[model samples]
Each structure stands twice: as structure tokens, then as C-alpha cells.
Target: MTIQEIVDKILAYHPDIGDRRTCDVIVGADPNRECTGILISIAPTVPIIRKAIEIGANFIFVHEPTFFSGYDDECEWLEGNDVYEEKLALLVDNGITVYRDHDHIHAHRPDGIFHYMMKHLGWLEYLKPQARGWEVVLPPTRLGDLIAHVKERMGLEHIRYIGDPDAIVS
Candidate 1:
């Protein structure tokens, strides 16, 4: 598939929310070019771009901005910056098409990040689908135990909560 075809598929699946068309765009390279491989990532940093080139992937579906700015036309700050130019050059020279999927991915009914987290933590069975996203009404348990459960399940070493350790959460 070409980059444009992949982008069209994403839009068909997720669409765009209301007036927020800030994301879901091809930020770099020629979208019509056929893709060799696709790399999906949360960020399109220089290292990630280089890694994509190394892996022979010509399409990068990034969840964040390719350029330094969120606003497309606000790249004046990046003008003449060596790092910015180098990154742009890499994408152009390597024929890498960079598409940003920030808003649409989150706006999708299931919420991609939430779905992944729930599935990864074995909590999908407890998921309660809502208009916005999935929510789980966990049973009452001590805050400390809840924290521990989250830490263990999420593979997190540190967690912060806004309640007493002894407090029960429903």
C-alpha cells in the first residue's frame, strides 16, 4: 500500500473529531510513494526516523509531531536549525513518509491507548465501554493494595495517588 492509502484507511477507521483537524496528516515525504514497510510509534524523533530507515520502512505512523511544533505553520522556530534540517533531509533522502495520528487515534471509540493498556494489564474483561472510552468499576480495595496492583500489572515502579493509602477505592 502507498502512504496515502494507509492514511485513508486510518481516517476511515477512526475519522476526525469535530473541528480538531490539527493532526492526522502527512507531515513529510511524498504520500503517493509505495511503502516498503510501516513503523508505528508514539514519537518520530531523529533516532526513530533513522531506525525506520535502517529497517527499510518507508512509512512511519507517528502519534506525535514530526516537526518541533504542533501547529503546522508554526515551524518558523525550526528554520535554519541544523537538527531540524538534518531530520527533514533524512526523511526526504530516505523516502520516508511521516504521518501523524494523534487526534484520530485518541478520538476512536475504544481509545487506542486505553484499549492497549487494559488489554496489556489483563483488565479488558473489566472494561466498561463509554462514549469517550472504557472504564472499569474496580471492587473496593485499600488504596495501597490498589497502587500495588497497578504497579505490578502496569510494570511500574513508582506511582502517585491523591488519596490515603488506607482509603478504600471502589
Candidate 2:
């Protein structure tokens, strides 16, 4: 399928997006290009772009900005920057298309990121729905243990917390 078709499919999954302005957009390459393969990632780093090129994938759907700005599409300030120029050149030269799906993914039912995070952390069963946002209710455990569990489950090397490690949490 074409890049635009794939993007439309993704947007269709989030009907609530409506006509709202979103950060989700094609940040590089041609949307009309036929997709050889697809790569989904948290960000479009140099390594990620290289991987896409190596894998013969022309379409990259990312959860974050391609450029280092809040809005990935705006690059007037990044024109002379070496890193930005290099990254942009890599995308353009390699014909790699990048689409940022931040806002719509967050607007998804059950919230795409949170739902997947809870699932990956094995906390889906403990999820408690609230009026504003959801919460996870875990069994009483020491703060240290909870931190360790989160780090392991999320494959994070280290995390910073403000509370006493020995304090019990639920």
C-alpha cells in the first residue's frame, strides 16, 4: 500500500481525532510513494533511519518528532544546524518517508501509549479507570520493589524517584 493509505488507516482507527489540529503528519519523503516496508518507532533517530534504509523500508511511523522541535514539520530555525541538515539529507536522499503519529495515538480509545505500556508492564489487570485519567492499583509493596519491577518490565536501566525506597506503596 501507499504511505498515505497506511497513514489514513491509522487515523481512521482514531475517529475522535475529528478536525482537530494534530502533530501527526508526514515529516519526510513522498506520501504517494509505494511502501516497501514499514517501521514503527518512538523517534526517528539517525540509527532508525539507517535501519529503515538497510531494511528497504521507505515508510517510518514514529510516535515522536523527526526534527528536534515540538512541531516536527517546522524547520525554519533548524536550516543551518548540522545535525538537522544531516538528518534531513539522509531522509531525502534515501527516499525514506516519516510520519509522526503523536496526537492521534494519544487520542485513541483507552489511549494507545498508556494501554500498551500497562500491557507491557503487566499492570493491565490492576488498571483502575478514573473520571480524568486511569490509575494502576498494585498490591502493597515497598517503593524500592515497585521501582525495580518497573525498571525490569520497561527495560529501563535506571529511573529517578522522589520518595523513600523503603516506604510501602499500593
Candidate 3:
């Protein structure tokens, strides 16, 4: 299927976002091009783009902006910038289409990002619906241990925290 078709299919699963403008858009290459493979990521950094090329992926589905801006479509300020130009050139030359699924994914029922994050952290069962948002109630544990758990679950080398490591938390 074409990149645009795949993007449309994803949007179809989201709740009606009304007529308000959204950040979800094609930020690079041609959406009409047939997709050979897809690379799903949090952001389309230069390294990620290179990895996509190496994997022979013609389409990249990202949850964040491709350009260094809140709205990826606004590129007037990025003109003449070396980094922006290089990234754009990489996408264009490699024929890699980059699509951001930001707003729509957040608008999805149960919230697409948070739901998956909770599931990945094994905290979905601890989720409690609050008036304004959801909360996760974990068993009491030391802050250091919780941080280590998060790092292991997310496969991160390091993480930053601003509290006493020995402090108990839930």
C-alpha cells in the first residue's frame, strides 16, 4: 500500500478530531509513493533516518515532528539551516516518506501513547482513572529501585531523577 493509504488507515482508527488543524502530517518525501517497508519511531532524527535507509524502509511513522518545530509543516524558519537542509536532503534523496502521527494518536480512545507506555511498563493494571487524568499506583518501593525498573523496562542506559534514591515511593 501507498504511504498515504497507510496514514489514512491509522487516522481512521482515531476518534473524530473535528475540523481543527492537527500536527499529524507528512513531513518528508512523497506520500503517494508505494511503501516497501516502515520504520516506527518516537522521532525522525538523522540517525533514525539513516537506520531507515539501511533497513530499506521507504516510510517512517513517527510520533514526533521531523523538523525542529512544534508543527513540522512550518519550515520557513529552517531555510538555510545546515542541519535542516541535510535532514531534508536525506529524506528527499533516499525517497523516504516521514509521517507524524502526533495529534491523532493522542486523540485516540484510551490515549495511544500512554496506553502503550503503561502496557510496556507493566503498569496497565495499576492505572486509576482520575478526574483530570490517569494515575498508576505501584507497590511501595525505593526510588532507586523504581528508576532501575524503568530503565530496564524501557531499555535505557541512564535516566535522570531529582529525588533521594533511598526514598520510598509508589
* TM-score, cand. 2: 0.91
lDDT of 2: 0.87
Local accuracy of candidate 1 as per-residue lDDT tens digits, 16-112: 5777557557766899989899998888898999999899999998878888777643677888999888888898889998888777778766888
lDDT (10s digit) by residue, model 2, range 2-92: 9999988987887576786777879778889899999989999999999999999999989989988768777899999999999989998
Give lDDT per model, in order: 0.81, 0.87, 0.89
Please name the candidate that would achieve the greatest TM-score relative to the true structure: 3
Candidate 2 — which residues are off by over 4 angstroms?
A: 131-134
Candidate 1 residue spans exceeding 4 A from truth? 16-20, 128-131, 142-170
lDDT of 1 at 160: 76
Point out the worst 10-residue segment of candidate 1 by lDDT: 126-135
Show where candidate 3 strays beyond 4 Å: 130-134
Q: Among all windows of ten consecutive residues in candidate 2, which has the lowest summed lDDT?
A: 127-136
For model 3, residues 1-170, the per-residue Cα lDDT tens digits are 89999988988888998999988889778889899999999999999999999999999999989988888888999899999999999999999999998988788657888888889998887877651235678889999999999999999999989999999999
* Candidates ranked by TM-score: 3, 2, 1
